[model samples]
Target: MKLQVVLVLCAAFALSLQAPSSQECWCELQSEEKAFPHAKLSMVERNVSDCNRNVTPKKTLELESLVLGLDRRIALLHRDISVLEKEDDGELYGVLSLYVVENEMVEIQQMMDKLNRTMKGDQHLTADVTQQLTELQAEMGEMETFDTMELVKGRLATQLLKKDLDNCRKSLNATVPPTQPPQGTCPHGQLVNVTGPQVFTGGEYPGSYLYGAWGRDPEPEPGKENWYWLVMMTVSNRYSNYVRLYSSLSALIVGKSVPGNIIIHSSNPTTNTIQGPNNVLYRGALYYNCYNQLDVCRFNLTTNTVSSFELPKGTRYNSKGNFCNLDECYPYTDLDLATDESGVWVTYTTNQDFGNLVLSKVEEGEPPRLGQTWHTAVYKQALTNTFMACGVLYGTRFVSKDVEEIFYALDTVTGKERFNVGIFMNKMAPNIQALNYSPVDRMLHAYSNSNMVSYKVWFE
Candidate 1:
């Protein structure tokens, strides 16, 4: 009986050893199958890279959806393996019996160890792949963000360019002169029907002319049509007032109530009287001080009275300054006046030592005061001379060691600058001085002092 029992135990042990071989065969087959999915995953990674390189947005989206589906399938496979590990079977009992069981146990232990190592290796590989994918996705997201921002900026730039182009077109269209005048025309020499606020060339009587006069001839004669009213100003003097009138033949002094002039100095060569102009259209108006003692005066055109204003201050003309040419000297000129529908603006230059270009504005109110002030630094050594022409101010300054000319529109009330419509005409010439704007024709007229050459400027 004892021998039979021992024999039975021995047989049982042998069966246990054989069972593991079968189990191992199955595990190996499953592992091999699992490797197919891993290989497919690798191929998928390659395909993703290729798609990223060559596919359109629609195709890329499709491929990403496929990848997500693959991920779901992989998760289901892991779930299956977890379920199998939880099951128990009697056949597995034979695999655990002693002698053959011992041998089988050692083999199974070795297999388990190897399986653990393989699983650990797989986990490491999965972690590495997941990290790589995450990084790639983040990089792609950043690229998309950059692309979006660039698109917006490009659109904004295009819009701005379009607006500027439209403005240029409008300016050009307005420059064309009228073809004919009213049916009945007056003789050229005689005062033509005193046109609506017409601007003409005429003479030099300080107080009589509200707008100043410029000499039409190099050497003006007493009554030889040598001067003209280029612009309107608020001050006037009997002989050297700030305003004057002009016609084609000659300039004359016409007394009018000037609207926006703040007199800084008034002396009679010896005992000059500094009292303000009496019964002026813009008298007692509020204004802001600009460069030097110059101030900007605002007035209501409808009421024929002044309001309040502000302007830039500190710009002054220096007699002993560097020269662009022998004829042009430094501290070219001080603040000139300009006005727009909104308020007043001024542009001025500091002395060569300060090396700055200044612009200022005045707000509309009871007491005129300066508003925002802006300044640009300039090179002292490159300073050049400047001048005012046809009531429009123009100047020359050095840019990159080359003389660059600039132009500005003045605010008649505030002495600030009008940012729009101001242009630099250097390409036209350097010696140009006279400038005039025709309201009806919207043309900018420019001329040289000594030459008969005249230019009509319109936007291109």
Candidate 2:
């Protein structure tokens, strides 16, 4: 009886020695699989694992898309807040704009709440939101802290939102417009002040597709001079592969137009995919920043052939650089294609140039190549849009809801630069998303505030 009891006690001691330590044990699927493999499988309830769901490829992509959408909304929110700040004196839109702001603030809060709910299922994504994100969210949620009068008189709440939105831009890498310029002295002479919002046409897709370009071709085939073209950023406000055509300004205004839905290499991103609103129709072809690559793509309407040439290696692409001011960073505006009295030109900023505007001619050829390049002293982030007119590169900034200042200019001919061009563009919109100069009409076509607005450029 004594011997039997000693044997049983020794067996129990051996089992305890072999078992895992309570403090160090973890519930990994791989670790569990390796456990007790020689013994009969223990009955498990097989509950769905939070860890497995979080690691799924589909779920990961969904989270990333959600994050990007939130980032973009935050930017737009900041832009609206800026508009409210401008209108606080009851000068622009009166207190009506305040109602719009309040409504948008509520929508943004709903987005945050959705994100937080989705994050509860994802531990890894929660880490990405971080302490700073939480703080920014809290700051944004304090919209009700101010009463109507306090909010109207002072911009304290708006200022906090602006600061937090800027932080969001930094977190999402919001960095920073187009043109093929002419040669030597342009035919129209030096571009002077741009006057009037001459025409405002909100097309069929108006109040939507807010980011896009609209202008006549600088060098159209004989009978096509009357044609005005528009390419809305239909995909996530970042990509478009087709052009819509209106026979004339009147036709465009009346929304009588043909769909130029001709695919210019829709399958090949490196070829003719338009990535930003900074694209233009020049000399019977559409030139734009190639989607997903740092290259200039020219899609010849005549041949229907798409050809592209790579930009300078270090040249920024994919929204790494953008036209940004206090309110907003225009999305995916890394490469701008513009036309002038001379010919085709492209503009961008490079790390080597340190965010200053770098201008290069998209040299006209079998496959358009980059030509004589110039670097300017003006910071790209300071301006909202840029266009090349008469061989001179002009830049504009948001002055107010009623005025946009042509605050910077670079005479590519003389290599002369100025920070205060002071040539103001009379505004019809709060923000100019796309600005293109047409040598054909001697006008600047601006896609602003969900409306197609054009300004007559006075030239010396």
Model 2 Cα lDDT, one tens digit per residue, 1-460? 9999999999999998999668776575543222332221111112123334435555654565566556656767788888777665646575777778788888888888888877786765557445435654565345334343565436877888999999998979854313433355776556655656568778767788879998988778898879988888887888888878878888888888764466765553334588988988987789888888898888887788888899887888889999987877988999888888778788899999999889987778887788999988888888898998878888888888767898888887689898867876666568899899887778889998679998777666
Tell me the tens digit of each residue's lDDT in model 1 across 149-221: 3776698899999999999999988866543332112122211011111222222333233322132322223
TM-score between model 2 and native: 0.60
Point out the worst 10-residue segment of candidate 1 by lDDT.
Answer: 189-198
| TM-scores of the candidates in the order shown | 0.30, 0.60
lDDT of 2 at 378: 84
